[model samples]
Target: MRAWSGQWRPGEGFGEPLPAWDGPSTLVLVFASPAVIADDTPPDPGGPLAGLLEAYPASVVMGCSTAGEILGGTIDDATVSVAVAQFASTRLRLLTGPIGGGTDSAAVGRDLAARLVAAEPDLAGVFVLSDGLRANGAQLAQGLSDGCAGTAVITGGLAGDGDRFDHTWVLVDGRPRTGMVSVLGLSGPHVRVGHGAGGGWSILGPERLVTRAEGNVVHELDGQPALTLYRSYLGDRMGDTAASTLMFPLSVRAPEGRQGAVVRTVQALDESAQSLVFTGDVPQGSIARLLRANTGELVDGAGEAVRRADLVPGLPTLALVVSCVGRRAVLGQRTEDELEMVMSRLPADVHLAGFYSYGEISPIGEHTSGLLNQTLTVTTIQETAA
Candidate 1:
């Protein structure tokens, strides 16, 4: 794979990423955080992607707007940022459709799978990107997972807005929107892919059963207000509850499909109402776990991510990391140290790129990897010989 990057000032138009890419091999594009776009920008404008499409043209492109972007695993700023990589062995295919708020993900999945399967190429993995503005996150993630089969793996994230939930934009075809998802199906014998996550959460106390729920909103838990259980855990930090825990979500997976959880800050807490107001819907009868973070744990997790990126079993074309924003916060000022560890520990000289995700969608443990909750996650892409 080949890589390219560019930065634009605060009021710049969507333009090609610096160092135009011109190669016959297929292209797989990964992008960094997109800011609050200038006032004159169109609602669903191509934005920074205008330049990306111009360069790759037929190459399959997929990524999300982020709170911040890391090109080749480094941060870029207030201007647009781009990292383009070329893979000579893999075939890249792109797809997009309505996701969240009344959409058929099963159909969307099948359509994507059919296109990928027809190619019958040895699989590397599927890269998915989402607009993290709504509750349909899990639904859309499942749709893409179901759509592709016989694939090496799937990795990506729910785009973030620094800490603002309302500032997400999904890559639609080549455009950006609030209610869309973009996926790139990469299949080839030479493509190498591996993923892993850090370990530390010791399930504290018995699991809290979900007494009532909807989509991502939990009105009640164990027949009591959901917030009450949460507060019980918060103790002195109750004042910092929702805002502190907004990026963390209860993650679950059924034998049937993948699940993604991203909690918005609490909307309201009513004891008499026996309800909890949530920005996203949470189904009743789901489990809720108190998410916790320790400085040491977060840094160690970065090493785990690097281990996966380096162990992918082949020559890697590039490494794209999709980590939970919650992890960054937990580490605080020490976050840069984590970045340094990741950049240095991974196999030397691999082009690295990634973004802090609102919710990470990379695989780690075989059982519950796809939809990680409030944890650091990593994914690596490369090439392997037959």
Candidate 2:
């Protein structure tokens, strides 16, 4: 496989022209800043993607808006990051569908998975990008995992609108749109895919039982208003729940006979209802603990994730790093440290491309895929000789 990656700014086109490839590209992943995607003003509202489409017109183009864009070892905001891959023995297919609302997320995932499996019976792996704000990430991941039934590895993340949590967009066929989910299916014996996730967050305070909850919305914890209990932990920083909560996400343990404990970050707060809406589900009767992490722990976690991915050494590989927007908010100026750590841990010939997302989708154990937040998720792809 041959890969090329570069960044594009508003006024500064792509820093340089795409390197000429001997063969047609197989997949093009485009991660753009929300600012570039939301600028639907007049001429060229399509932003930098127009150039990308013209460059890889035949490739399966897919990606989403991000809290921050990542290319190679560098991280930047308000810019577009593009990665084009030409695989020798891999076959690719793209599937997309509308997500009417949060409740429709699971169904949409199942449908997408069914279509992809039917189209490619030997489906090797599936990477997904979904509407971050409007879709229930937990349900979507579950549906995809169940639908695939251990046939393929599933990895990807939700689109992000930076820290706004207001609007997010997904790119399908080089067009950015809202309330949609896109799946990229990879198949062929030579296509190798590996994924790993890590979060070095420490639990704070005592664990509380989720007394009342519905899907991703938690109304009460240990019989206390969920938002109120969470505010106690935030204290003075409770003013901006959406942004502040990123610093302290929740560690939720699902009910018995289900996926194990996973991280959940606040997506919104209902002041009137005294509830907290998380990026993933916090099931009623489950245990919830607040989590906090220092810079060292977070950076180490990134390296640990790469170690977990276990990519083969000395192979041309593409590593897609989907980190949480919360991690970016907490890392601040040191955000690049995690990205640099990822690059250092990966193979020397690696092409790194990804974004900070609203919610990260990765497998927790074996074939059990789960939606994660405030965690670093890595998906590596390489094609061996046919």
lDDT of 2 at 224: 97
lDDT of 1 by residue, 255-301 (tens): 23344333233544555655565543455655555544467766776
The top-ranked prediction according to lDDT is 2
lDDT of 2 by residue, 223-316 (tens): 9998998888779866755777777889988656466689987878999999998877888999889988899899989888999887777778
**Model 2 lDDT-worst window of ten:** 38-47
* Model 2 lDDT on a 0 to 1 scale: 0.84
lDDT of candidates 1 onward, in order: 0.59, 0.84
Q: Global CA lDDT of candidate 1, please?
A: 0.59
* Pairs that collide, model 2: none
Residue 338 error for model 1, in Å?
A: 2.6
